[model samples]
Target: MGIEAELITAADLPRLEQFDGLLIRDHTRIDNYTFAFAQRAAELGIALVDDPVSMQGCSSKLRQAKLFEAHGVPTPKTLVLTRETLPIVPALLGLPCVIKEPESSFSRGVHCVASEAELVELVTALLAHTPALIAQEFLPTGFDWRIGLVDRQAIFACRYHMVPGHWQVVRDAGTPEYCEGRTEAVALGDVPAAVLASARLAGDAIGDGFYGVDVKDLDERCVVIEVNDNPNVDAGHEDGVAGPELYEAVIGTIARRAFGAGR
Candidate 1:
């Protein structure tokens, strides 16, 4: 895999013409430069790990809720949050529900509200800057199953354990007190069939590109958490069990898409 690659930043937009493909390794948001890069790559007919469509879809939890419902993908109870919907939240998702900003990344803008007071406080704070938010049923789980997929196939799997005494993966993310949980990559052969099936369905609902579908294994049943584009592939975490093959699978897909082998 002697693929010549170089690091780039937002300032290097003019130099994009020199590359056959692009792999975005940064947190993507609808209003960010990453999305612009994806759009530029698409305009240039370049192979990109996550096409602009995928980035846009994955950036909005509201859109994802509708997408999952339309595709019949299993997910926790989720609803769009607005000032009008505030009073009905408790009735819809109950207390201890989860609230998320549409463009949240790295678990920064996600919060678990255990009481009505907390729900209102958090939702009000979030909605002050954004037009809407997403409220989801609280599904308490010790860990979440992350299924990495490329071209609608599972390449690697890992269990992201929750931080102790916390309900989400990362506590105080984007702050000085930020801390995260443990990650244990698992062999694809050992992953539960239901988890894999749900992840594949979630990925299919999004697009046939790179994705990391997060799932919760509750009582042997699988519930999709979210579909993440431009998912992580850290050396000792996502690539732990799969080893070099993980890199090969991802790079090969990009190469094929770049050279018109499977575009």
Candidate 2:
């Protein structure tokens, strides 16, 4: 990744030009400058991956839910609400819901509420962090599967073993000793049909690139929890499963798609 990661400007883009393609991974929700350059570069045929349209959609949880649900992909119940309409969640989706900042990522501003009172408190606290919020159904499960897809095809998938004390994985809960042993990097062959359908659903929804689709098989029912365009790809543990070829294959696919096949 250290291939001269330069922070270029909007004006600089047109001035200097020598690259295969450009990928905007500056967290567009926060980086306005990068977003502007990304827009301009795409118009100039710079080959921007995760096109601005797709990035914007995946950046918001509310949009992601709508995209997934609209495609017949099963996901946790979600309701995009303003401050005034937040109170109606209990009456609509009933008690026990998750309140999260739609534009937030990595479980930074996510909370689970088991009761109406909890929901109110959590919702209030969450709203203080961001204006847009999504009240979603709590996906109950011990361990969830994070299926990684490269260009609409399954590459590597593993069960994200959650800690007993903490239900969320994105949060930095100190050492991973709190979690289970190595994450089994099961081949695409072991992926169940419904799970495959869930992955395909996300791919069709997102329509591009290396994405991590979090799917939960709760009580024999396959439901997608979230589709992450930027899924975690760390493989630095001894016990954890790390398929080197799986890793290379994704990178190759990205390069092939960005630059031609026989480059």
Candidate 3:
């Protein structure tokens, strides 16, 4: 991480073949490096953290929506709109919807719109960031929950603050915040049933380690957003269950799944 990215990217490909386990982070950028490595790794019989097929599939909002529906997980009713085919927003999910980039990371291209005028303005801003976006029905009642999965298990979970008025990680928008978030020790029953099912589906879909599943629960049906490949384990840091114990579990899971050496 300290070295220059291009240097690593330009490094010898033949040397990389010496390793038995291939982690995507070996590539400086996941989209570029991970994708390229995945294509090559498949031939070498080495498994990638998040394979090319799942990463590519989850890269597009449309594909994610299909996965959600197939798994019976409820998500915001959304439309895949390009520059040419912008759908009517209200008829699909009503006002105060969100327009976001399908492949954006770190909330880079996500916007909350309240009205038709606001929607247009938000869309304009989003296009500047990402031309391809998903217009989703807004679920303002609750903050979007991020459930981190390790080896198809919900080991860590947290809820992100859409609005800081409620329990949230960070109050400032510009700065990254790690609030001592109140992450409930939930079983599958604590979360919306559909969310757990969807989380498992996402694990199956991505078939990787360190997955962060985004789900929307309206006290009833839980909607699946997308499965993230580089999911954060800061959840333990947020809740203060971190240090050694949590770290051990994380490493143990990775050893079992990634190396095929653990029980």
Candidate 4:
């Protein structure tokens, strides 16, 4: 907490060596400059939150599917849907399933299909862009547990309620009428053990870095939806329970990694 920090932009790439660590708060994409910054930071031996490994693993649903499977992380029945296998959606995942693009975020590039007609139509449209998609068994729930983890340890846990009359957390994001549901942060100890365990498994599957694992608790069983890097830690939302300690832990981890990891 005693460290001095300053915000840097893409144009400040030359100045990267001046800092001991970099915390990337911007939207990260493999093809974007944010990832390039991470690469450069790693090259310069500067510690980074959402390291390159975490970014690569968390950016794609296809990779996550395999990662979870390899590590035995509990997740909904999922399959990689390609154009060749479009007809098997109903037979495999059934109707009312959830479809997600590999690089989807903030509820964009995701769809809920009700019937075989919808499944074919949506997957057809989506495949035109990417060769594959993710189809999973629908787990209907009122809210999702977002557990924040740093270095594979639970830091803060919160319930992200679904938007009123919507199935996802956010509705019409990136639009003028965009809206999202409420967030209630709970103490880490108060979170369900299964939920925390699922999040931990997910974090372990990914690299040991900052992660926010989304888990659904249904029928008294918890299953991970996905592992995300650079998860939101809004002022009054995720910090409601952990408060400043959460921020300090995150910052401290980055500092330690900066001075400790391969430095």
Question: Which candidate wins on TM-score?
Answer: 4
TM-score of candidate 2 on Cα atoms, chains taken together: 0.79
Per-residue lDDT of model 1, residues 135-186, tens digit only: 9999999999999999898999999999999888889987899899999999
Question: Model 4 segments beyond 4 Å from truth?
Answer: 261-263
The TM-scores of all predictions, comma-separated, are 0.95, 0.79, 0.73, 0.96
Angstrom error at residue 216, model 4: 0.2
Could you tell me which 10 consecutive residues in candidate 3 have the lowest summed lDDT? 1-10
Better of 1 and 2 by TM-score: 1
242 Cα displacement, candidate 4 (Å) = 0.4
- Which residue segments of model 1 deviate by more than 4 Å? none
lDDT (Cα, tens digit) per residue for candidate 3, span 80-197: 7665545477677787777777765555446667788877766666667666678887776546677767667776555654544632233333565533334443433356666677
Cα-lDDT of candidate 1? 0.90
Candidates 3 and 4 compared: the better one by TM-score is 4
Model 2, position 149, has a per-residue lDDT of 73
Q: After superposition, how far is residue 105 of candidate 2 from its true place, in Å?
A: 1.2
Local distance difference test, candidate 4: 0.91
Q: For candidate 4, write residues 3-62 as lDDT tens digits.
A: 788988999998889898999999888988999999999898898897898999999999
